[model samples]
Target: MSRFVDIRIDPAIVRRAARGDARAHEIIYRAFSAPVYSIGLRFTRVPAHAEDLTQETFVEVMRSIGSFRGEAPLGSWIRRIAISKALMLLRSAWQSRGQQLDEGWEDFTPQRGQDGNAAPDATIDLDSALAQLPPVGRTVVWLHDVEGFTHREIAALMGKTESFSKSQLSRAYQRLRPMLQVDEEELADSKTTAGTVLGSC
Candidate 1:
């Protein structure tokens, strides 16, 4: 999925966009909007804030399209803009609380799955599980795993050290492992039960 999003677009369309062709601009916007908004939501965990960031990202994209060399995929360029805008919002919010961004990590306990059951394995919802993570943890996991950003890239985006991104990703995986293991065990049990029933029949 990440590879698909990072696929290169036609240079002609980009040139047309850089020249202020409205149709070309719209095409680019329509193609990249979902992924951009997804990054926003994953980072902010708020639909409204995500929408605002998406708009801001596109605005920046349009303004800077003239300078967009074909060195990288247009989607990659837009993703950087989206990440920058989202990080700006996060930084502002943290500052408003008179808090330092380098503060210690807070302990995160995985919440029950959407089914209100202790065994999250019964209902394996990746998005639900990801959403349950704290903002910093969720951003690290999504950027590293979903968006295919390197730990160093993520650290630069978050204005933290590479070690911070690595540590946060490690913590997120630690919390997610048990929840995912439960689902694997459940699948094995179901297959065994099915085999036994067939044998009895």
Candidate 2:
């Protein structure tokens, strides 16, 4: 009785799941949970939110898998739900908690370690640099670059113009380049300091 499903599924399996086949439901959930949670973590930056998003996505999946209609891959369908849920959470947090999406660069300065030494070299890694971006910038970067969402798709999802998505992604990259790359001026200054110290020795 379920609607036609995706290339990722057998119609009979969808039907059985829709008809209360517990094993079929389990199969679908297990198959899709990793991708769902992956996007959840990238968008929310919290493992707990990712875990919650995964559960919420599968809840909708189980409830509405009958109406899939084979429009795309079932994985894509599940991902759409997860993205919607993640954006909803972001919006809720921004509105209710007054979360700031455009924090100043000074505020994102890498923190010292517990022993008060500099942050580890890992701070220069892609993941850490991505985390330094403000929320809107970070979301656009991950959605467009990591998730392979098109500018048009991202704009539609965020209720903005395509140019907005493009600009946000641009700004995110502008912000990230400095974080991820070494600065020539800083390198030169450090070399100068090293030479002076060596001369003094």
As a whole number from 0 to 100, the lDDT of residue 8 in candidate 2 is: 70
TM-score of candidate 2 against the unseen true structure: 0.75
For model 2, the run of ten residues with the poorest summed lDDT: 192-201
Runs of candidate 2 with Cα error greater than 4 angstroms are 1-7, 99-124, 182-201
lDDT of 1 by residue, 77-150 (tens): 88888889998998888788776665424645666556755464524454566566666776777677656578
RMSD of 1: 8.4
- Candidate 2 residue-wise lDDT, 1-201, digit = tens: 011122276768888988879999998887778777877887788999999999998999999988888767777787888888888888777767555444334455544567665445632355666676666777876666545578999888877789988888766655554554445443223233222322122
Task: Kindly give the stretch of ten consecutive residues in candidate 1 with the minimal lDDT sum.
Answer: 192-201
Residue 28, model 2: lDDT of: 87
| lDDT for position 89 in model 2 | 85
Per-model C-alpha RMSD: 8.4, 11.0
Top candidate on TM-score is 1
